[model samples]
Target: MEFQATLGQIVTAVIGAGLQLRYLEEYPEPFWRPGDLSAAAWRGRLPNAFALVASRPG
Candidate 1:
């Protein structure tokens, strides 16, 4: 598989597109536990995962 954009690049592109960044977080391994598959539980469990919340201006 080929690599694409990095997290920073993504954020930059989002902002450039006129979206407002509300929340941004990096989910490291320590933030999760085994057998945690729920949305709130699996956030930091997966590898190379991040939580980014953005929205367009009203």
Candidate 2:
């Protein structure tokens, strides 16, 4: 077997904001459709919930 080593090698990827992911504790799948999720799934339905992912590799 042959092996290759990588040191401090960084790849590239994309990142964006205003993204939201809502999963259920009982079942990870959405109650309805895949994207048919609201911001008020866990809390008392305040207003908004979101997540931000880094776009570029640092």
TM-score of candidate 2 versus the correct structure, residues matched by position: 0.16
1-58 per-residue lDDT for model 1 (tens digits): 9987888899999999999999998765544356645664356544456789999999
- In angstroms, how far off is 56's CA in candidate 2? 0.8
Give the range of the ten consecutive residues with the poorest summed lDDT in model 1: 39-48
TM per model? 0.60, 0.16
lDDT string, candidate 2, 13-40, tens digits: 1212322323212323333443655555
Model 2 misplacement above 4 A: 1-47
**lDDT per prediction?**
0.77, 0.32
Off by over 4 Å in 1: 30-47
